[model samples]
Target: MWDLDVQPLISSSKWLQLHGLKRNKLSFSQILSQIGFQHREDFVSTLGKFVASRYADGLFPQYLRAQDGRVYNLTAKKELILHFVDCLTGAIELYKQRMEWVTSESRQLFGVIQESCITIVLDFGTVCRAEFDLCRDALSMVLSQQVAQLANDIIFSTAQDLVKWQQKAVPVSEDSVESAVKWLWKLEHMPAVSHTSSTEALLEAISDETIEAVYYFAVGDVPKDMKHLLLQKVSNSPYAIHTVSFNAREEETIIFLKELSQLTSGRYGEYYYCYYDLLISLILKAIQVGTRESLQRLLSHLAHNKKIKWLNGGRELTVK
Candidate 1:
């Protein structure tokens, strides 16, 4: 028999060891050897900060599984990691400025990191929770109310499946998915519907389902416990739930995201795009408006520094 089991070698620590580093114990020099590259750690380190500012988004590229647990790592990407670091550095500076301007008496901000919904950010201190909720509700109503028509047509293999499915589904309410829960959870088989259905109509349709399964959205960064819950929810789903990510500087966007999250595999979140908290703090602190224009300028600065590479978008233009 072989001396080693193929499993333990794939452990998170082992995974990091193969790459020659530990995540929290991160250092430039250690990372280089771990990933089997002989590049300068100092140079790579710079790029990580930049990525956080304008482009640090979504799942890390590297992944490891030891035992039954899983983790997505980013240290492997020499370029991407550095870019993110540079961006984070800039983000912190801006954050500092905002903190300085906002007196503790008038406003306070709270930040939390969740494990399961790794992408969702819940960023609001207790003082501003009410204001944050108001903006989020407004945003959700817009997405639900302002849906565009998506009259997609689908053809079945034959009359039997078509008639059988139609007969099964037509009686369901066409309002929100919430209404269709009974049908979804109890029914033995179901056909997936298109996302174009109006929110009101969709819920109505949901009511007709005898066995409707309610899918939960991860509202904040997922914790390990939460991750298991989500996995259980989507175990039978055909589609993947890539995180629905966006930046919400104001109430409108926040609300839109909340409503949209319900339709997706689940809205797993990282940072709270609160109206009164993150936005107001940043504004007061002098974090430049995160408009398309300002973002471009930040991107340009990273590109010029070579901390970030501009592979797409305009190449000729330069930012000062």
Candidate 2:
């Protein structure tokens, strides 16, 4: 048995010798210790390289289990892990790029519409849900009091309306024309002590200020229970409501948002994957035509055959 052990030790020593390690003793433990140390050093170096490769390639492994239970070569396993790391790295970089692009595009779009005196009603309750940085950046571009007031009013009204609608047993129509006519009549002829006192405050605030356009940035779908009531309030308003739905997927939600815009004779647009592109397009169109066309069209319907020549186009347009 001693001889058998000695023979294997000698064979291992010879193998080490072949690999350029000159050893005099045929001790199994000593040979194994040396080999193990060298192997560990090699493994650490290879691991560093694998990490670097993954970072550079921006990828990572999708699966750890092989198709069959057969043993894989150690080198192949390392390569697979490296590939996975590469994919993960790539995905992160791409996301950063998209966010940067969106920010830049939004800034540019806002710049174009800032002087248009457009009242942008940013729905903090929806999709983007009023992310701080995004809202700050957008608000920074426009310094109009009307825009600021509108933003606050929309947010407040959304919350207040949701609560009020939930408490009330009355039913509101979703049709734009009927809602608008009824609401207008109520506002013009009715007393301020009516049930729509809160709505009257909102309308009075906006009407008192000169507003060219009302852009509603919907981040998500409105709650189903509040849809009809909210729509009635929005449609009844005198201001044209331009609804821009972002990242909305539900068919009913899309239709509802679109219908609101249509009912108010406002523009409706949807942005799924690229919000920046959609916003840029909307702003560009607004800049090209100017809000004068919309104002004139609105006036034509309300005034009915009155020849209205707009003097000093540079002055902010106000609907009285």
Candidate 3:
């Protein structure tokens, strides 16, 4: 129900007045500016209106059912319309708060952040990117809850997103370290003994540029070249890799853990997560405990002790 005291222009037959509407001189943008007063406000208003109209009569704003034209009447379309306008208006209002930081950022990190996610996730939960840790941290500060924990989720999620985008990345012959690291994130199965032409091709395509270490998240096996090289080449901390894939019978699991352990001079135990039964639930538990203190200790321990040269160029990305 809407207020009878406060009326909106679109509440009644105001729709009739604008049905065949064609403003003579003013451009749509200009009209939008006038209606919403600010560009951000206008943007939110437009989106909100569309969202609300779709679910105008629903008990909740997010879930809406369209009229079948048989069972349902035209209903209170104005309620839906007004709902959207208000919703959109609210989005802009809150967005303004975040923009304060967005405006301060030299890099338009917020803009670069996909808008589609802001409502679905970021509005309430934590999010992370290269340097967008600040927002997650800010959310925790604002809520006074486990903000850092949320940051971990964001980092993991963002890393996953980066992996998703790797397929489109044009690999370089030399400086393909970034792509290599990203690709490593996407791999679910380890390289089997089968024809690994695709995996080899992916590796050969990696440039000789300095790559500190890469995170290879695999469920099954790793390549022979990788497995042999990782285990035999670096022997300082052997259990490091074993810890990660404790149950990893696959060669790929052996390789990832070994390489990571060697990369961190046996400090891979910091990031290593092993599971006996369900690794999915195990990973979730790992995420919850990965705090700033834990991450710093893990990284600092790795950074201080230099056993292998691989970790020298770029430090392994810890849970932090």
Candidate 4:
């Protein structure tokens, strides 16, 4: 304590200070030396002109977020950015083509059916006797439309029981469709005596591993409790359960059936005789283009090198 080695303490403190300075200098050099890394700034500077005005502010940022989980400060190759733009262009073209087909050639039922072998589950008990004739006619129309296109089975379900026209899916033909129509008319005379839940009927339809999908043609309001039960039961099925809402009145029924289809990775259809406003809006969006002035700006941007030139004078020059 009396001779506390003062010189040694001072020497150790100076060594630590010098070492920290060297480390800080090395870090700064490393940061400055970094090169050839791609960044969002570079992307915006190089390709920002190609984006349309309406989308310029948000589209590239959103695209970057989806592609690399970054809206800015991104480290992505220029080639990767160009590839992403190409994919977006291709997808827009494909959507246009599909919408064209949907508007021109597709009916709700046939359009939603993506599988060759399917079961059509018609909930008959939900409709009253007065509306039974309408039900029969609609089913007849479906059979006629789907003739020779689908191999299908029809399961007719009432409040208490279910009936099947064929034990398994039969290949569609003129005779088969005619037989189905006849069987549907004959059902008006039969009473539902067997005890089976709607969920059980759906299970029976899905039990056939060969069946590719199930189409639930819902015509009226399903009980709220049963709706929950159906969703829970079908949510885990390996095959999809596409739902068709035919002349349904309750909004709740449409929403529940749509959710059921979404949960099972299936399609939903609204079957009506008239066109939907939604379809019209989609068609307009597919065919719409920018104004004449904006189109000219886009053309000039694309032909910048061919249309624009530099002059030897310091003043700016313009060419058309």
Q: What C-alpha lDDT does candidate 4 achieve relative to the native structure?
A: 0.57
- lDDT for each candidate structure: 0.31, 0.41, 0.30, 0.57
- Per-prediction tally of clashes: 82, 13, 10, 0
Minimum summed lDDT over a 10-residue window in model 3 is located at: 115-124
Worst ten in a row by lDDT for model 2 = 1-10
Q: What lDDT does candidate 1 reach at residue 179?
A: 32
lDDT (tens digit, per residue) of candidate 2 on 1-320:
12221211112234336422224322433333322221111235645642212231223222222544222112235565465456546545544543443334432233122223444444434322113234434444332312332222221122223221111112222332233233322321111122343333334334534555566655445567556665667676676666666545467878988898788777676654323333344456557778986445444433431222222445533223
lDDT of 3 by residue, 71-188 (tens): 1223335665475466556545544544354333211221112111011011111111211233333322322212111221111112112223233323232233333334334434
Candidate 4 stretches greater than 4 Å from native: 1-106, 109-112, 151-160, 189-196, 272-320
Q: Which scores greater on lDDT, model 2 or model 4?
A: 4
Give one digit per residue, the lDDT tens place, for model 1 in 1-320.
21122112122345335432234334544543454332112323656542222232343354444553333344455676675477556545544544443322111111111111111111111212333344344323322322111122111011111211132322212342233322223322322232212222223222333322221222322233433443344334332222332232334434443444454543333233332333344344345565775555444433433221222244433222
Candidate with more favorable, higher lDDT: 1 or 2: 2
- Residue pairs in collision within model 3: 56-80, 173-207, 174-207, 190-221, 191-221, 191-222, 221-252, 222-251, 222-252, 241-257
For each of the candidates, the C-alpha root-mean-square deviation to the true structure, in angstroms, is 23.8, 25.6, 23.5, 27.1
Best by TM-score: 4
Query: Would you give me the overall lDDT of model 1?
Result: 0.31
